[model samples]
Target chain A: MSYITGPDVVKYACSCGLLKPISHLYFCRYCFQLRCSFCVCHEVDSNFCGKCSENIPSSEARVKKNRCGNCYVCPSCQQELSTRIASKGPVNPEDSKSTPKKMYYLSCQFCRWSSRDVGIPDQSTVTGGWPERENVHSNRLQELVDMYKAIVLAQKQQKDKDKKKQRGKFLSYTDRTGVTAAALRKRIGLPAEFTHPILKNKPKEPEPASAKTEVDEVPEQLLTEPINLMEITTVEQRLLQPEAQPVTVDKLFPVHKQLSIKRSLRCRHCEHNVSKPEYNPSSVKFKIQLFAYYHIPEIRIVTVEPLRAGKQCELIVKFTNPTQHQTTIAFLKLNMDEEDASLDSEVAEVIQDLDQTLSLQEKQQMSLTSLPLSTSQPSSLISVPSRQPSLTIEPRKISQEVNCDIEVPTSSFILPPRDDAAEYDDSGDTHNIQDDPKLVKWRKSNKAFIKLNVTPMSDLALNSEVVCGFIMQHIYTNTVASKEPQKYNHKVKVFLRLGQLVGSE
Target chain B: MSRNNIKILPGALVCEESKLRGDITIGSGTIVHPSATIIAEAGPIIIGECCLIEEQVKIIHRLPFDQQNKENTTPVLIIGSHNVFEVDCTVESPKIGNNNVFESKCYVGNKVTVSNGCIIGAGCRVTEEQILKENIIIFGSKCQMREGLDRPGLQTLQMETLSKMIPNYHHIKKPNKKV
Candidate 1:
């Protein structure tokens, strides 16, 4: 089965309340919990252009407004525009030797839109000096932004001043002596100097924006003339060019290509990276990828009998062990009533560890993913403020229904470790092991076909889909470097969507 | 019916490898690259001067099913001058005007009529039964139409260079007419 784009008939309940396919889930080894995209923190790692595949530094991308400098997208069809050259006729007709001058213009081969359509002159150079449009309200927006920034800075300074006043009970030596720098200088027969703090000289306050009472009147032509659908820009097109979203077709200009970003996902509980892509934009590799598909056994439906309502049907499913270690699988009842005590303990441990990591004696404030400490904080502070302990997000309840009952087998089965060379070997079944014929149907290298019996509910309607869920408790051998290979029982809730029920027999 | 029926005017550069069928006439200053095919199934075909038919281009002039049974009378397919059939382009259009460009991998159906200064963009297919107006460009996924400001300029330098270099490596079809 193609898991990448295939319809997900098999899904696993993530640590969060969300239910997702196994391919989308990540297994955090330290915390031993299934993490999904919703449970992880996504952060931008790098920015690059999709057209040229050139990596743009984050700082440079910020300066360029997160757009490629040389590449342009068509304003009409949003396709990448290529530079086309036009050869001009020689200026001096008498001189046959004079070469024709070449001019470049941005043109889209897909939509046949060119810079000349908008009355932009062709440039003499290949990389055309295309004119950039400035936002008409940029000046007013800048003033507003400055005013807000100044207001925030003033509020922060006021808060700091309140904190300093609270700490003023422990007076300084100069205050205790009732002698300032000027008083001490006069007593020592020296020149006087002012003892006022630097904060006494206030910075200039930014002017706030003024709101006008009168609004601009609607144009008269809008009421009389019929609107042309082709000339008017769509909502998506306007959002693409946020600076000057021209309403008319002729006012549309080529936009610089937006840069793409590589994202790194961090596990929310343990703060470990579940998946971290390489910094180089061209490299499609990951530094840390803890996918659940690699750790947990993969289940694929091999064959199933025609399902009928209120009838037991034979279902054969194959399980593949992708890990290097051999594991044992057992069938457990899909019970949603019991809370997983181990999951609760793991979260509590993570919170305690986080508390120890962010001690008030050292780092008073901590950010996620081990972000660097604030650079604006001075090192001379003797006492650190104590903050509240970090709260842990509790594991959500498993919200799923098992309409069908799967007969749990008594005996467990053993799956051999994966061996790459065994695939090429024509010799079959070298390892002789006892297997219950009813439980295990067939066996191969690192793969086994197990038969199951399922009964749909009697009240299921005709042509209604039958879903069956089970708690698969498999023996997981952790191969951490610090400890010996330890085998632990891990339970994963899996749901399988069976075919529609047929007529009652 | 025979290769002897093909006529090449003076200054025309028709490569020997080009596949020509039926009564075909090539005008002066026309360059037909090797592997270009022209089939005049309906009748005689006349190509005008300064036309460039690049390699792998196919020009077919077939009569409609109703008129196929009419004997002793054959319709003529006339392609105007300064038209360029780019590489791998297939044109079954009944008529083509001057300064028209059928870009690379473009396909123009028999029902379509291409007028002056029209450009069928690369990989575009025009199978609809309609006439393209002058300087109209058809491109993009939706086949959006737009008016061109000016006609595409002729590749005189490339034509001059190809005329001098093609005859050295491959056999050339000699001119049968002085005009």
Candidate 2:
């Protein structure tokens, strides 16, 4: 016999007629139908840490009280204390300085609360924990419990009355049907089929005369109930009692304890011995093992020069990939304030093109040219003039198939001579000789354009070598243009380099 | 109504000197107090009972700017029950919720979410689509909070330090799990 699979299940509308995905739809066990967030009542059952077995509800987790039923705080400083394992021996070799017994330290930095003041034997050890305080007055406890029950019953009665008043105002059609059926049965001298069992047992009663007035004044009905002192006593007693406290051991420590081998290596050439550094390679190894396969691309600004208003400048961005797998750089877009038009248009074009190409490897260098400048300066930029120009690079999209190398050229340019005097000198006789001296200077500067050629690096990791060429051109043309045309040229080369470690094993 | 006969709903707490205009439906256990003005200019202000409207609470369904035109009316202020509106609270837009609390001097702008069991602290201003989670407590004055509580403490200095150590640490810290 062949097994037959049904057609792909179409997510029909919920019982409440809400069209949602199968994932969004939840099976209402009570209603036996699909329910969405809107249809069913969402009641938080418990607030529990998935790792630990500790759980507490929102009402019990009061900020002012600061006492969780399962967690203990140092009474003095209110810092959460953890449980530690300890051996019972005066001179246990395992409990020596080299191998100290595990102890819980409930120390608060704010108030310096320590667990030592709580009279627990060995503050560091979990043995002889804080003594449990028990109430010897059993009779009082029983009386208080009885009083609480009575208060609850009275409160419930008041609530029922208020609900009845509200229900009376509704005037449902079922009530009319019930009345008509009862009257017809009485006229025919037959039993009423629809009459409820509970109602059948009760004698017929006349309707209240002030039913309308009662319904109208439902809100006031709740306030008429008298407060019971017995209920308050139980509530106060519960609030005053110290809550139960539990110990929490860090789970990570147990997993890390198994791999606690401390190994050291020495280099013979330098006659230098390398002990275990503060930054353990094993820890880095563990992180790599955990997240190397699933790493996301991150873009950051390595360095930025002086931000020019309404002028174009180059930005050097450094991209780092900690994962083993290579990441393709699809597009590196920037989000500037909408008001800044200088970089908007030019940067958009450059990013759009870069997005089409560029696939960067793990720990690779990629640099792009022609970064757009922001026309309108940010308020912070204007106030802090000395601050370097910063650009936020957002990798718009990422891919794995396509990759392109980013070439950042580092070079300086010298402006060419700007002279139109020699060519127009032959026609000087026909033209006005008293031309504005400023006008002549203006024409000279306009004719000049800077040229630059970058020297590519053979080894990208060479830090001592100059990777970028910068030139600040000061045009001394005595031009009478409406505004002085001041231009600046700066170039930057972005590449990845291994940072130095003070001490490494 | 007699002073003793004024039924204060389960969660409803009203502050002093508050004036309520027109027919307002407060749900069970709702409280409203002195000096707070809940005005239903165009439509009724239906607040689910059990909501706590703290001292000096001001809920205006219609903007004072819209009063110029007779035809153009304001939206109704529909608040759900079990909400705590703290002292000096001002809600402009109609907000709906249960078990939510707005701390002192909170300014909830137009069209925001004060979701279930959220505690908004004193002097906070919510302007955008701020979706607070259940049992979430925001403490501070004038926070530009955003939607999605999954990324808690993203804009804080602590997160910045982590980002400095490991680039894109937030993306790696927790798996993308949506509640």
Candidate 3:
């Protein structure tokens, strides 16, 4: 007997006629049925690396080859054997004067065929020269051609399937308009008899008093509008077969127009080809026009904390725009390891409305607090966070300011101890250097301020002090191309450490 | 086994004391070294020219099952030219083609077709129904071609190393022997 805990429980027999726990069953969303592992047959389709294969429960064996990486076979007898580099020198090389020759072993399990009997050279024995083979076949020409053709066909099929699935959904005007008659009339023209009858009967229905009262009793909103029957209906032209009679042309050719009296002229002095030219000579001077000015933002690292395995740290990021013009920042993006590590493609977006109307500079502070810990294990002293914790917008105007703060948990950073400290201490101390009181107190009071000057080719500076590390990212905008902002993003990660004394005074 | 009377055609290799019983047709540009035996019992063994037979290679016509009944045995081993047979290689009723290189100690089963320009690397065992394509390089022999070499996701070199080794042997004629 099994006991059910938590929530309502439903028990049913599997297709294999076995009773299993609910967690062991799978719910098929398409068929709305329960499926167990035993109910369906699983086939291995492909083989991957053993480490990845074990982690991937649904992986199949690689169809191309079944053998593991380390196994090899004897070419002569088709038997599995161990192939290794034979020792060359004597057991104690100092005692023996002769050089040892390396050899390879090929032992057959069935016929007991050994390579030693044949005097074959080992792999290590031949370094530069081409090793010799003993057996050659004469009729293997057609097999190679068939293999190449099959591989090309499989790739083409996969590309077609991917294109079919990549079509995106977007709203269009045709989807909203339900013009059924208009669409049919555009495809096929209207009949002539139906149009003629409507024109002849148009004036006969409006003259009766009873019909006028019925029209007036109808809703005022519906009766007030004049309905155009021609606009509501559509007529399409139909191509009919021509009468079976051949028509003859009266004139074969038409008279051509007389040529005008024109003469081509060439410059006699310069030998240049000349044509009719319009002479418009005004005193003209070229002038350079500048549409908009671009400002480059500055980035600086404020504070960094190398979070120990059990410890937690917070990262504070600040962005300031010291520009004079009001700017609208569009979007901010962060990248880690040359790849977009954001959980979503559109991770951070900021729309800054700076006050450019008045000369007063507006500064907005955004605190990105409580960033989640990265899932990767820490291996070094500086735990490079898999993803950047902060992102800001592209500043629109020059000298407009926006500030953003990112509070990263202390558990994300893990700093490894220095390995070369043994000679300096002389006592072979193995204590964690992060436990020092100075380092702890320094991390508590770590703060950084970044000042941004959004000038033409402006530079930003960021400064911070903390046990962990800090990274600052700056994005600048270009306004030359059709009002679309081109972002030039930059980032820097810095690790902080306390200065140590080299020698005793 | 007269050492002075050993007759080797230009670019043709014959293993030491490899007693050829029946009529054998050896093509031009073939190599057969000493210490390798090619015995043709019932049917004639025809070895095409430009074929490389390495040291200690054995090509016997007699099947293992017919050892007791040697008088009623019928098995023919025909090898084509321009093929590289590595050391200690064995072929039994194998029909090989041009530009194929067999690495060290390759075991060829009965009636296997080794396509042209195929590289059978060191220690490969090819069984029946195993058809290797031209310019196909098999790494670390003992790869049985029981199923036609149509397995998906198998990566192979563009031009086989064997084809590059034996240049001017097929299609182009040149008097050179350097591998």
The model with the greatest TM-score is 1
Positional deviation of residue B3's Cα in model 2 after best superposition, in angstroms: 23
**What does candidate 3's lDDT look like per residue over A1-505, in tens digits?**
2332122122222222333334344322111122345443333322333311221112222321233333333432334544445666664677677667665554443323344433444455322122332213212323434444555555566667656656746644444786554465565776423343224333322222233433445677558888543122111100110121112111111111111112222222112222212221121221221101112122223443432222233333232232222222221221223222232121222223322222212111111111221122222333333322222211111121212222322221112222343346565434333432312222111111322111111121223111222332333333332244433332222222311112211
Better of 1 and 2 by DockQ: 1
For model 1, the stretches where C-alpha displacement exceeds 4 angstroms are A1-4, A89-99, A164-232, A340-391, A421-433, A503-505, B1-179
Give chain B TM-scores in order.
Answer: 0.93, 0.59, 0.60
| Native contacts conserved, per model | 0.53, 0.00, 0.00
lDDT, residue A381, model 2: 34
The best-first sequence of candidates by TM-score reads: 1, 2, 3
Candidate of highest DockQ: 1
Best first by lDDT, ranked: 1, 2, 3
Angstrom error at residue A260, model 2 = 36
Ranking according to DockQ, highest score first: 1, 3, 2
Against the reference, the lDDT scores of all candidates come to: 0.80, 0.38, 0.36
Q: Comparing to the true complex, what docking class would candidate 1 get?
A: acceptable
Off by over 4 Å in 3: A1-505, B1-16, B62-76, B129-137, B141-179
TM-score of 3: 0.21
Alpha-carbon shift of residue A255 in model 3 (angstroms): 78
Candidate 2 residues lying further than 4 Å off, grouped into runs, are A1-505, B1-17, B63-75, B129-137, B141-179
User: Model 2, B87-157: lDDT tens per residue?
Assistant: 78887755556666676887777556556666555677776655555555454443522122221111235
